[model samples]
Target: QTDQPVTFLLKDRAPATLSIAFGASILWLLIGLSSGIVSALRRATWIDKFSQGTALAGASLQIYFVGLVLQFILVDKLGWLSSPGYVSPNDYPMEWAQGMILPWITLGFLLSAIYARLTRAGMIEVMSEDYIRTARAKGLSTRRVNFKHVLRAAITPIITVFGLDLGALLGGAVITEYVFNIPGLGKLATEAVSNVDLPVIVGTVMVAAVFIVIANIVVDLVYMVLDPKVRLA
Candidate 1:
C-alpha cells in the first residue's frame, strides 16, 4: 500500500474543479441556447451569418490558445481580472467570480458554439413541422410559437449534447485547467500521468465515470419533463 490513499488526495481538489466546470457549463449552455434561438429566428440575415462565422471560428480554436488569449487580454493587458488561479468561493465569493470568468469563458466557448449551431438547426427543423404551421395559422403570437412550441420540441438533442458535455467537463477540462494553472481534476490527472501514479489515475477515471452516469440520469429525467410523449415504462 502507498503512503496516501487516492481518495484522500482527491478529496481536497475535486470540489473546486467540479465547481468551476459546472459553473462554466451552465454559462456555456445558456449562451449557446440564446444564440441558437436568435440565429434561427433571424435566418438568412446578417446576424445569422455573423453567428455562424463566429461559431465556426470558436469550434476551430483549441482551448489552450483561447485560454492564453483571454489571459493576455483580460488579465495582463486590461487588468480586469486576476491571472489564472483558483479562488475558494466560500471564502471569497466576489474574487472567485472574477477569477473564474475568463476560465469559464475559455472552457465554454467552443461548446457554446457547438450548442448554438445545433440549436439553430434543430429550431429551423422544428419550425417547419406541421404543428408549428397550425399554431401560426391559429393567430398565436410569434414569440409564443417560437419559445413555447418551437423550443420545446427542438430541445431534445440539445439536452443530450449538454448532458455528455457536462459529464466530460466534470471529468476534467484538461487544456483549460492546465493553461489556467488551476489544480482541478484534469490537471491532477495530468500530474498523475506524468508521475506514473496508477492509483490516482484510476481514482480519477472512476470518479469521472460516476459523474457521467449521474449526468445521463439527469438528462433522462429532463427529457421526460420536456417531452410528455416520453414515458418511463
Candidate 2:
C-alpha cells in the first residue's frame, strides 16, 4: 500500500482551485463591469477606445502567455511579487494574497474581455430603449435613469455570463493551475492524463460537471428574482 488515500489527494487540492477561481472572478467582474459601463457611457471617447482595445488584447492573449509574462514582470524583473506557488491563507494571509495575485490577474484579465464587451453592448442597447427615453422625459434624475432604469435592465445578461464563468473557473482552469503550480483539480486531471490514471480523470470530470450544473441552476434562480416576467411565468 502507498499509505496515501486517493481521497486525500482530492481533498487537499480542491481549495487551491476554489480560492483562485473565486478571487479571479471578483477581480474580473469588478474591472469588467466598471470599464464596460464607463465605455458605454462615454462612447467615442478615449476611455471607450481604450476599453475596447484592452478587451481585444485580453481576449487574444493565451493564458499561459499571460501567466508567464506576469510572472516575469512581477516576480522576476520587478521583484514586486513572490514566486508562483499556492500558499495557504490561514498560515500566511499576506503571502497567500501575494502568491495568488498573478494567477488571479492572468485569468481575470483574459475573462474580463468577454464581460467588458457584453456589458458595454448591453448597457448601450438598454439606454436606447423607449422606456429609457420615457424615464428621462418623466424628469428622473440622470443618475437614477442610468442606474435604476438602464443598469437594472442591462445587467441581466451580465449575471448569466457571470454564473457561467464562475462555474467554469471553479471546475478546472487547467492552464492556470499548471502555470501557478497550484495542485488543483485541473493539475490533477492533467497529471492523470500523463499517467493514464482513468479513475482520477473520471472523478475530476464528474466533480466539474456537477459544479457547472449547480452554477447554472443558481443562475436560473437569480433570473426569477431579477426579472419579474420570469417570476410571473
Task: Encode model 2's per-residue lDDT on 1-233: one tens digit a residue.
Answer: 22346677677878899989999999999989888999999999999999999999998999999999989999999998898778788998888888888898888899999899998999999999999999899999999998887888988999999998889878888989988898898998888788887777777888789889999999989989888998899
Off by over 4 Å in 2: 1-3
- TM-score of each predicted structure versus truth: 0.95, 0.95
Per-residue alpha-carbon lDDT of candidate 1 for residues 88-122, written as tens digits (9 for 90 to 100): 88999887777788888886787899999999999
- The positional error of residue 156 in candidate 2, measured at the CA in angstroms, is 1.6
Alpha carbon lDDT of each predicted model: 0.87, 0.88
Q: Candidate 2 deviates by what RMSD?
A: 1.5
Candidate closest to the true structure, highest lDDT = 2
The 10 consecutive residues of candidate 1 with the worst lDDT sum are 1-10
Please list the residue runs of candidate 1 whose C-alpha ends up more than 4 Å from where it truly belongs after superposition. Answer: none
Lowest summed lDDT over 10 consecutive residues: which window, candidate 2? 1-10
> Measured by TM-score, how close is model 2 to the native structure?
0.95
